[model samples]
Target: MSVQRGGLGRVTHIIGEGLEGRIANRHLALFGLGFVGLFFVLPILLLIPESLNLGSTTPFESYRRVANGIYVDAFVRSFLYGFVTTVVTLALAYMLSYFLAFSTERVRTAMILIIVPLWIAYIVRYFGILLFLSPAGPLADLTGFETDLLFTTPAVIIGLANVYLPFAVLPIYNSLNAIDEELVNASRVLGAGKWRTITKVIFPLSLPGLVAAGLIVFILAAGSFLGPAVLGGPNQTMIANVIAQAFLDNFNIQFASALAIVYTVLLVGLLLVFNTLFDLQEVLGNI
Candidate 1:
């Protein structure tokens, strides 16, 4: 009986040791997740009470103000910018990604070149665009034609498209790369021409990446402050710029917090809508 009890105790100890080892292996990942959650949650917690108008007994007053005409226009303009930027970025990125995925032998080199622009600071890139468009800048110097291009809606769109182009490219390229080569061959064997193969086979398979890229670019562009602030004129200011002005220039934290909360909720709602309409989980997984 003593021998039997001793054997059971040994088995229990071994099982406990294995569980500890398994947990140890996952500790780093758990810690990383916790750290990121804390980082994101702390700011949100700080903002929530302010957004609710803490200590003022006027909950949602700021939100009511945000829904007024002026702010409503800003929201509409922001969405417009997001949509236009998404369309332009998608057009440029799809072609580049397709080339990189299917036509290129130097895929690594081409990808590196495409990503090189991102290494420069975002502000610097915008400034470069500003300079290039300026009357005295290189474009004028080369063409001997001066034009005023700064502080316009077109300038803002150009800046956004340039800045977010790589983001769209990478996901689309990933989707295109994931397509089976055999599928393309099979399509060709079925008497499909080059254009038809691309339209039917490649494009359908790449929709996940395209959708993911569109969502990402639209979100970023819609929430953008710097691009609009620097490249846009008075009328081109976005919701993000308005939000910043509420906090910084006007020193209205409550209003700013309300705007932030509203904007965040709207974006989250949009994402939820998209997820319901499309298989966003599968799209994200493919990415």
Candidate 2:
């Protein structure tokens, strides 16, 4: 029995020693980087060659087409909708999160309600919104007001904002909740009004989560294919819809790739601008 115990100890030591230096924090990055390289970077790089007509005199023709007319409008609409949706979502989420953090006696109940929608698929929720907003649907049937909201720009923005609101709420709530109550007490005791305290103290401290939420919602909303396709009109068409139509409907792979590359560049450029304005490295570090 003693010999068997000794043998087990030696085996455990050997296993521990083998794992100690072979696996590390940096090694985890290797695995992640490998996956991103194979799946993300490789695929995006391949789009460049696929987008070009290698031997043709007008190899750059697809890019030229992408720069003009409806395609340009699609790109503009995508960013515009994304920006508007982010703004609306943040305002609503911040107000809700502030209430949940400070005023609520049932934070768990409120959070569960907020999170429940996220479990429902995006398509299902958007379709439900479609039915609710349709002229013959509930708003008209119950209220006697025939609404023409479906398949419009406002409808698309509302759908995107609703779909992404839970995402914004969770982060902002965390930031607000993590704040020390004493700071708030001090602000109140120092003669600051409720509105002034929120503006001066609470809002500034919550910027980290606000920025994180904005980044997430903007990226998701901008690249959305289903929201605009399901809820928007021709005028509200976005970049993702254009890309999908080119690839799936028209089977113009080169043109689709050009659209994709341009969209990606624009999105990244916006993120760079956001980071410049917010100093994301500094802001997100707190969160």
Q: Report model 1's TM-score to 2 decimal places.
A: 0.88
RMSD of each: 7.2, 3.6
Go through the candidates in order and give each one's C-alpha lDDT. Answer: 0.91, 0.93
Residues 49-71 of candidate 1 have per-residue lDDT tens digits of 88777567778889999999989
lDDT (10s digit) by residue, model 2, range 176-205: 999999999999999999889989999999
The Cα error of candidate 2 at residue 282, in Å, is 0.6
Can you give the lDDT of residue 35 in candidate 2? 100
Q: List TM-scores for all candidates, in order.
A: 0.88, 0.91
CA shift of 149, model 1, Å: 3.0
Model 1 score (lDDT): 0.91
Candidate 2, residue 16: Cα displacement in angstroms equals 10
